[model samples]
Target: MTPVQPRTRLLFPLRRRATALAAVLLTACGDSSTGTGQPKSTLDQAVQAMGGAEALQAVTNEVVEASGSRQSPEQGSSISTPRHLSNFRYIRTDELDGDKLHIEHDHVTTYLSPERYQFTEVVNGASGFVDGKDTVFTPAQTSGMFTSRATAELGHTRLTSPLRVLRKALANPAIVQEEQDLEVDQHRFKVLVFREEGEPELRLLIDPETFLPAAARVLEDQPPLGDTVVEAWFSDYRDVSGVKYPYHLRITLDGVEAHAEDRERIMVNVSVPAQSYEVPASFQPPAQPVVPALADFGKRSTQLLQGLKYLTQTFFYFDQSGLPITLNELAPGVVHVVGPSHHSLLVEMKDYLVLVDTPLFYPERSEATLAAIKAKYPGKPIRYVIASHFHSDHIGGIRHFVADGGVTVLAGEPSVPFYQRAFSNPHTLVPDRLARNPVPVTVEGVKTLKVLDDGVHSVEAHRIQSIHSNDMVIVYLPKEKVLFVADLFNPNLFPSNQPAPYVWGVASGGLYDEIQRLGLDVERIAGGHGSGTGTMEVLRITGAR
Candidate 1:
């Protein structure tokens, strides 16, 4: 038997970027320090306060470890819910090895700067398969490595390692502003702001008395999201080998408190291994599908899933060797538009036409399917669309029907809430029919049965208690002795190598049950995923492999 696959959303393990760690750590720029400046300028004062440029530049290596709960971007309606909030801890080791700023993270990833050395995953116990080996993992592309590298440079330089930030500032002498007015903690103060081309806009609130950094703020683009704010407050100043640093740190995002870190010890002039940040040779990413990068896992996974929907539509829409959409005339005023993956039945009525279960895998497929339906029956519009269920594959192209003004979605009562969420959510990224042309989410929900008859043909939708999708809507045609079911029945039944989980296997779980109970005549079983016409007798007697 074919493997009973899990839901599409739970198939792949969703990945995470710095997320909680990314924004929180950039704020802890080693507390505040006092120093002398002839002009007492913002840059000079901050430089002196941070143990002087000579003291910071004189340092070699550093390391830090932090633990926090990361919010999952996928949970809430408006986003911002941690996927698994278990308070996972992580140890991050940073080093400047041979003109390269290197970093190793736990549960995250590693990076080697200057010339990005790539590694899908490099941790000793981490998991990833790359280059046909389990030891060292690498993605098909090495862009993630560069992303990690840039993040590390900003984090380590600004927070724990001050020299890197100072180095960049000195390199670009005009990047820092002298004096600016700012209010913090209900007090007015003079501030020094650092601006860069692509990097986050940094601001350092200065204490006029000691010329030390009171707090820091960074405005960064967390992909797929607009620029977000990251702020850090440093306190508990202590001297570490003649260099003062903040032992206590507080970080926040968008004015909401995120997380904090308390330093156990601050160690400078540490020894880093020769192979500490070693990575695989440079990789040249081959041209491939354009995948989107987002601020959080929610958007990334959503985008990827949507991308798969489009890909599925394209593959079936342009199958060169596959069968063309055959228009089967089962009876007068009754036809089925059969395609490679699925089929749709068209029943012409007196004034309008009724289309059963639009196999809307993609907008492309919908366009093709709707076009064929339109071509077959010239003038009449598909006034009512019977959506079998709320499966992604079945619903991806649902917008096509909604765009046809006054098209009512006839669904089961169980699927009303789902259709509501689907219709209301913002599709700003990829505007569809509902997004472009707004419409009231109209669904003629079938509590027990909903009959759409126009004097000539009648399309009856009966709610079935199917094992596959509990809220299954079986579209029955009494005159033609034909029925259209969504996932409950696969008209293209195959002989499996092993026994199927159900008595009927992948054919139909509750189809015969509903048919026998209702005593309706079902000669031909038309399916949403039917390859061609199927008979109910052959379906049951085929027997489980």
Candidate 2:
């Protein structure tokens, strides 16, 4: 798998520019002691911003009932189908006990405990007892419990709520205004802006009438998957206790939509004993760990002598924007490599080229990579596209490329038919450009086939066994002694000097077995994501020697 885009670090800028600007502005507007037209101080504003102490204290528990779907741009299996949807309900109960507060959730929940000083989790199905003092769970299910809790907290928020919407803006520190005028819900109100670490800043669009957030926008340095903006809309505000909460929330991540809900009822002042957050007796975590094989390759079908350039690929993710973008690159000439989700390679054989993987549907990087490839190698035209697998990031840009008259697409045999059926369906997740001009594909079969027989630098192709995907192919260059493969390996960890097998290739030993079976001479190897080039010693370290 390709490495996720690194989160941009905004600490220095925040401390240097944002904080200084806020301080300077505060100082300039000071001495308005009467509090007449002046905005409240930061502390006072923080208190008032949260609806005052009375409102905050009014609610003790919140149970919400909602049903929605979770769609992953990484998930290509559910494209044009309802299978992408996962219906669920969420419940959260925050019990304040004196200075210590214990929060619990009916579903899997992630939170920072009162006593532990660290975050913990409570999984659903299995019962957990929490003492109003410190929340605890059985050691057996610790991983699952904590994962559930954290996922709930983060996933539960609707991008639409006033608080959440504002929180999104405040995530950035660039904007200094306490409030600025913005329009939302057919009304004009003062919205706040702040700069966060990376690409874009956070914006809070509040309702002028109630000071509630009607919507929020996050800005990133790059655009979203489709080279568009991202926005979260918070709606269905209902007062739970004294706190106003938006029941329905919709988030357009680069353009993909995700939703969540709170079910049951909101509880206020319903005190609980300090011993409820304790470990349950029935909890038992299994002693054995489930380690997935990463390097399992089945067989060799074909090789692309030219497709080995992009073997070492790295991706960076830019989010919280209207159109979040992820960036990565492919080695030149190494065309048509496939992997699982977000793990694919598309190399344009000619001087000017196009890459298939835009980083898990983060199109900004994809576009950048294309432009960079073209700019770096002047006079080359990227007129061909290929997918390594059926996952979203691998093939999401097919329409974009195809619309540009890119010809001669190559993909897994299984993928060709799947795409043929998908191209004709309603394109709700993304637009369908493959339907415009049927993409010509050279699906790999049982035997190996060479794409180009250039005597000086020939490209070889092969079909390999991959546990991650059934119809996967690998490209090789006999002359260059380089291999362009996907999902089977990542060369990035080479610089870190990490141990062999690297979790990915070792997990799927089939690739190693096939390499040995075919007995192809290879000195260097590249991957679809992560590291691009590395010596064969990396795989040999995992017992292949």
Candidate 3:
């Protein structure tokens, strides 16, 4: 049995800040120093304002129903319009005493096409599950990884709940609380900082007039943005069973609104069956896949899950190790680097190599790919990396190339500034290769077409117009009669018998139009995703013309 990969958006743990504490405790009683000379800890005041410690601690279970939208900053159609899931519905139940949490999410996404997604995630103690069938915990040998991930997710949810945080502060004496005065949007706030052992510090801002928690924030490391503040603002308080609950909630990343929700209802001490958190007796989770040593990059392979549409069995565990670099030759000098979920193309030039896309979120995967490229093509350095678009999955590993030294990145004109700013942001929270050994990032903007000819090999990078993304760039290899693109068309995903107006028909049609407009000869199509290269017949079969 192979372990199923949890939904990409479902299992990401928030990055923690690694910096030392900076703010000092403003007096033991908290930072309310006025001429009146009042002495009271800020945490105590916040707890009392939310119906006191006794009422909050007595509550053992909570159920919240909310609706909102989820945004993917890197996958947006343009700089101003990001890819988002609208009409989002969320239901979360927490058994505080049992240290359990369950979440149900449903939403509709309208980017290149319209699709609906629904999934359930549950974390009980050290074990977790997805869709009640796939285990999220690895084997005992790698138990620490699961523990840290589950703990971070559980801690984040608790911090967002005013009642839970207050109960935690009252129960743990070792936890330290400090106070500071800060102003945002011309409004003064009394910020209470809570620090716990082996956990990220949380800062909760209090409204001076109402004494209620205005918002809670924590510093975290998110690549591209680097060290950023994630905040959850609470408002529209309503009383339910002698306890105050915030009906309206808004979340922001670096002061930009990312999510907003309105609670339809809130229940305390709800009767939840214990079996909800238990794993089925018949189910056994597979062991974690071990990463192969650098020397065995091309020799080792393992089975792992892939794709976001796992429920329909459209995706399943396959024999493809995301750790080992697999290169498939499409032409003489063109190689397609394939992975379970994403793919990249490497083009060998006269003196240097040009990698089509850096596909993968984490830096380690990119590092592995880079190592393999160096091994295959010994002395030739990767001089230029062409970004297909601004999506995270396509450009997440751009920093690794920059760290390779003297590498230039070519992107659509509108996305050049975004990459420039993202590359310059501080990565102190989780330092990658670029952060450890600092180097300047060079980005060139391509408005329409940029050609690179080494006298022997000629590659044309063209900015194409598409509904999927305005910044999409497709690489054309005239000599080899091959084209490289991302998202616009995935041959493996489209069925030959399927009708017109395919899920990706609009974007694929746009790609076809672009090829014809440029009057370039294209025989094969390579993608930033899928397993193999496709032919022009794939487009014609899908009625892309």
lDDT of 2 by residue, 1-545 (tens): 11121122331122112222222123233431235766553423432445654565454433344444443333333332211323333344433321122334222211111112122333222222222212222222232222222222232232233443333333433433555354433355445665433213445555544455656665311111222234566666666655666666665433445444433354455555544344444342343221111000000000000001011111111111133223233334554232332344444453434344333443343444455455645676655444555554445455445444534455566555544433333332233343344444222332345365434445556666665565566666676576766556666643434444333545335676777777889887766655446556666554244
Off by over 4 Å in 3: 1-38, 111-119, 132-156, 281-322, 497-502
Candidate order, TM-score descending: 3, 1, 2
Model 2: per-residue Cα lDDT at residue 149: 23
RMSD of each: 12.9, 16.6, 8.5
Shift in Å, residue 179, candidate 3? 4.1
Tens-place lDDT digits, model 3, residues 1-545: 11111111211123422222355334443434434675556676677678777888888889999987656555578866745535567789998766688777675655333556565656665445456222211111111113333444465576578777767778884574655566666676777777765456777888766678998877665554455577789999988777788999887666666667799989999888987666443221344222223112111100001111121221222223345778888888789987767788899999999998886655667788888899899999988889999876688777777775778888998888667756776665556787777776678888999999988789899998887778889999999998999988776666745433544677777787888888989999988766577777777666446
lDDT of the candidates, in the order given: 0.51, 0.41, 0.67
Show pairs that collide, candidate 3.
Answer: 76-82, 76-83
Between 1 and 2, whose TM-score is larger? 1
Flag regions of model 1 displaced more than 4 Å: 1-326, 496-509, 542-545
TM-score of each: 0.49, 0.43, 0.82
Clashing pairs in 1: 1-498, 33-49, 71-82, 72-81, 72-82, 72-83, 223-295
User: Which model is ahead, 1 or 2, in terms of lDDT?
Assistant: 1
Q: Model 1, range 371-390, lDDT digits (tens) per residue?
A: 77778788887777777765
